[model samples]
Target: MYSFLQVLWFVLIAVLWTGYLTLEGFGLGSGMLLRRVARTDKERGAISKAIGPHWDGNEVWLLTAGGATFAAFPEWYATMFSGMYLALALILIALIVRICAIEWRKMVNSTKWRNVWDWAHTVSSWLVPLLFGVAFANLVQGMAIEVVDPSNPMTGVGPENVDLSVHVHNLTGGFFSLLTPFTLLGGVMLTAIFLSHGSLFLAMKLTDEMRERATKMATNTSIVSTGLTAIWALWAQFAFGGSQPLAWIPLAIAAILLIVSTAMTLTGRVRSAFFASFLGIAAAVAFIFTVMAPNVMKSSIHPAYSLTLWDASSSYATLSIMTVVAIILVPIVLAYTVWAYYVFRARISVEDVTPSGLLPYKIRAGENFLTAN
Candidate 1:
């Protein structure tokens, strides 16, 4: 049986991931929709401003989740990272480029400069969530893991130096091994959900023509998102849920909420739709972690090689110290996040957005670039 600290840490890690997905989903979605939904430069600026105040803050949850996982499950972290090194590196690169694009978008007055940054932002936004979806799906579906006996000198660890009883579970699959039909479906499902969530957010936070466009987009995407979510959730639960029958509870809730979100979007209830999508995302993330508990990483090679929460956890003393630190810091983070959202709760419009860059420029039909006040 696992200790209370081990189980508690697992739940806490899940909460962190839920927070990240719930908050950042719309931000990434907005980035993806930047060019598609907004025709004019001013319209694009409004979309960026809508998410600007919270996007960077929202990323903190992801950082915290990674830190917690490293401290609480060192062995799981090591093995998963070793197997997923290339994928993770790509994700990191995409995130870095997206951040730079968002931050540097208004650094120049030229239209070409902003256009290049917008394209970068849109591509990276799409890549990050799709890659994350694939990663999470692999967690549920299991990986190619094999147990290595140190007693065998051929296994790399010298028999004379290492204990014979110590065996390590290592992931033997390469990057190509991660791609499969089910995992690809998972990636598309996540991307669609984010698109709907973002459109709903824009519908709530914009006015006039932009709002109408966003609402129409939300209504259409929500339907697609609902259908895909149903297929993916059912597939994940039935195919890879193992002995955890109770995992169906959160999965059911996620499906229900997503349906409600779709209905709300269809009826032009922007605020309700956005809130439902937010909660639905959180519930979906909860289901993923729920189905993955006990076994942090399932081994496809053999049942005995699966890494359980207890087998991968830190020492009791280490957990005790970390728990103390988390208890003091978590609440503070929550309070500030809530406060920031409340402060930036006002709606935006195209007319409300001023010209971007220190010296904004306009191009006439026959003239060269001209500075605009």
Candidate 2:
């Protein structure tokens, strides 16, 4: 039973992370492409139109991840979130900007409004991954926390809730031993992953001249990402001692895929390259999780406040109920998500965003919907 809980715990983390990478991957990709679009408002509008239909739906993965964390690993949630409140708040705000930029950008007739959205979209899009990387980097690196011992020190809010012993300060407080080279490496790694993920998304969405540009960008980003991740892995394994030998195995597999995918993109096999990038990111994310598994959050303040999977999980009955409920509804959620993506598959069109000269009935005719084949 304990073992089962552990499995559920790990799987939940994997699913949430995977869902995040898959869903947001395209938005990042599209944003990068759109940022490179010709200066003309019309061209940028086409870029926006391409990504607008699916951006909001993609963010649902975050909600799913958060809900799962709340249910499956409530303790970790409380500690990390509460301690990291300010950073999380900034993230939520950035999410708002990214979503609003996507939604409101083309809804207006004025180029000025569209331009504003464009900046918001680009800045927020890039910042999301960087800030997220920082947060995760902080976690992997651990935080400073003050502990409350119940028996000896007899500290804590109450008997049932003694885990709230530690506190997380600002994103990077003035604590003497705050910064670590390893943590920065983690952040850089995350940035590389997201950038590469975004590149593949561009290749998948656009075609023709724009598509060719995307292909090139994807190739470049994947190559750099592969190299940087490899270097970082070596550093982590040897200098930082952050990752274990076993963890390097999946990471090695990911590296192989990363190289293959980069080569595919270089050869102009866009679809194949796209898949390879996806596979590589998946493997790397898994490798990082596996490497950082046992300690969700360690602390410089006190060892007692440090949290682990076993110490932070929900009860047996709760896990059982969650497992059953997730078994049923999770599939439906996934199906709806998949169906929506399939229904909207192919490249986005400029016509979709622009109101035609004709009435609504004629607009629904077969001519406007152009899928990127």
Candidate 3:
């Protein structure tokens, strides 16, 4: 049986991931929509203006989640990082490019410069979600893992020869080896889900023509997203060994909520639609962590090699210290985040700011400014 600390940390890690997905989902979705749904430079600016303030902040959750995993479950972290280094590197690069695009959009006055950055932003945005989807799906499907003893070790003389057997290790075969049908399905579904989420977000944050286009996109994408999500969740239920009955229960509810979200979007209830989408995403996250519990990372090579909560966790003392630190800091972070959103909470429009190629890029007061332009 796992100790209280182990379970708590697992739940905390899951919460961090959920926070990342929920907060970043719309941002990624909005980025993906930049070129497709946004017809004019002003419309694209409205999209960028909608997500600019929160996008970087949203990524902090991912960093926190990764850090938490490293601290709480070093073994799992070690294996996952080594196994998926290339894939993670790609994600990091894409994020860098996307940030450059967002930051550079207003820096230059040339229409060609603005156009180039727009496409760059759009491409990077799509890549982030697509890759993340694939990565998360791989987590659900499990990775090929094994534990082995190091080949060389130091020996000491303590009355006689003493062997140091302190190091224990887990290994993986890298990200490419993890691409399977189920995981691919997961990637596709999440991409669709985020696209739908982005559309809803744009609808809420934009006005007039932009809002109408976003609403239409949200309605259309939600259908595909909901369908794919349902199928993916159901596949995990029947095909995967680790999935639990309780987990499937929430997934079923999430399906219903997603459908409701779609309906609400179609009927022009933008706020309600967005809320439903949020709830659905939250529910899906809950179900995923529920299924992944006990085992932080499953081993496709052999069940015995799996990294269970007990095997992956740090020492009790370490956990206790981290728990205290988190308890003190998490609330402060949350409060500041909430306040930031509240401060920037207002609809954005093309009229709210000058066009991309304008001489001086400037935003009106009380709006979340993307560029110094």
Candidate 4:
């Protein structure tokens, strides 16, 4: 029963992460793509409107994933968060900046202020996904963890006590310690994937000239992301000594979906392209977690210090209660989420966002300089 609950919580946690990557991945992508693909205020507004209704809601997945980890695997959460606090803190800051940028971008009609907000949105968008990529890579690659018994201070070794007794080495080296060649590869691969995903989403949500431009962007980025993903997956499989040999199955599926996604983009199948990108991200995330399962975080210094599923899991009673709660509430969350998306499924266009004279401050393109006069 204990082992089964451990596995179940791990799987649930994995699902949360996968869902975040698939949904919020495009949100981040769309934010960054706002600056890249949108040439005018109307164009930018179109991009913003495309994602605005759903971006905040999409972020809930990340929050839920973090919360689930804290509840289901307290030890793992403690060590991982303490060890990588700097990186995680930066990610938190980026998320805050992103939210601000999205909300404040349209409050004023000044191009200068809007530009400032757009850049903020774009930078945060890129950084958040890149950091997640690097963080997950480091999680899979391993960290400097040292477990010891506070009770047995002199020996610094123990038979076992599950209470929060582990040491996470964060202060000594800081964020740079998390970077490695493999982890760098993971960061870049994830960035590319998010960029591609965002472009595909724009292709799906923007009409006319914006749609064509977004489709082109998706086609170009997907080609590069597909290659990076392949290399990252192969590197992970090789680095781990092929213990989970079957990871190749999903990895292959991911590659195939990515290729199909790009093909659909070329053929002007916008919805199909977006769907493929979403599933491709899910499959890619699945491959990573599947390969790293049973072991939450490995130790860079020594193998014995690794945090396995068994050692890091919460008590059996806690798991049982959380499982019941999740089963009851997850479907309700999904139902509302689906309804929200369905309600806002219409495409966005420049005409849809033209500022009306209803507001006290008039909106005009390039109005910052004129307003000052």
Give the distance in Å from residue 291's predicted Cα in candidate 3 to where it truly belongs.
1.4
Clashes of 2: 1
What tens digits encode model 4's per-residue C-alpha lDDT throughout 1-373?
Answer: 9999999989888888887899889999998798678999778878878888988778888899999999898878877888788889999999999999888878766677777888899999999988899988887787666566555533434324334445432222357888989888889999999999999988888889988888889988988988898888888888872778778888889989988987887787878988998999989887887788778887775666678888788889999999999999889878888999899999888999964322234545666634543
Per-residue lDDT of candidate 2, residues 1-373 (tens digit): 9767766766777777777776686676567556774346666676776667777777777887788778877877877787677767888998898888877775545667778888888878777776676666566556765444435443333323445434221212333333467666665666677677666676676556666666677777877877877887666556423445677787788889988988887888878877887777777767766666675666655445567677667788888888888889878878987898788777854444463212222234455533311
lDDT of 2: 0.68
Name the regions of candidate 1 deviating beyond 4 angstroms: 149-165, 359-373
lDDT winner: 1
lDDT, model 2, position 224: 81
Error of 3 at 160 (Å): 30
Per-residue lDDT of candidate 3, residues 87-191 (tens digit): 888999999999999878877676677889999998998888878888877777778766554564232123122222443445546656868888888888988
- The CA lDDT at 135 in model 1 is 93
RMSD (Å) of each candidate, 1 decimal? 4.5, 7.1, 6.4, 4.4
Worst 10 residues of 4 by lDDT: 164-173
CA displacement after TM-score superposition, residue 109 of candidate 3 (Å): 1.8
Tens digits of per-residue lDDT, candidate 1, 293-338, equal: 8899987666676788888899998888989999999999899999
Q: What lDDT would each prediction earn against the true structure?
A: 0.87, 0.68, 0.82, 0.82
Native-vs-model 4 lDDT? 0.82
**What is the total number of backbone clashes in candidate 4?**
0
Q: Can you list the residue pairs that collide in candidate 1? A: none
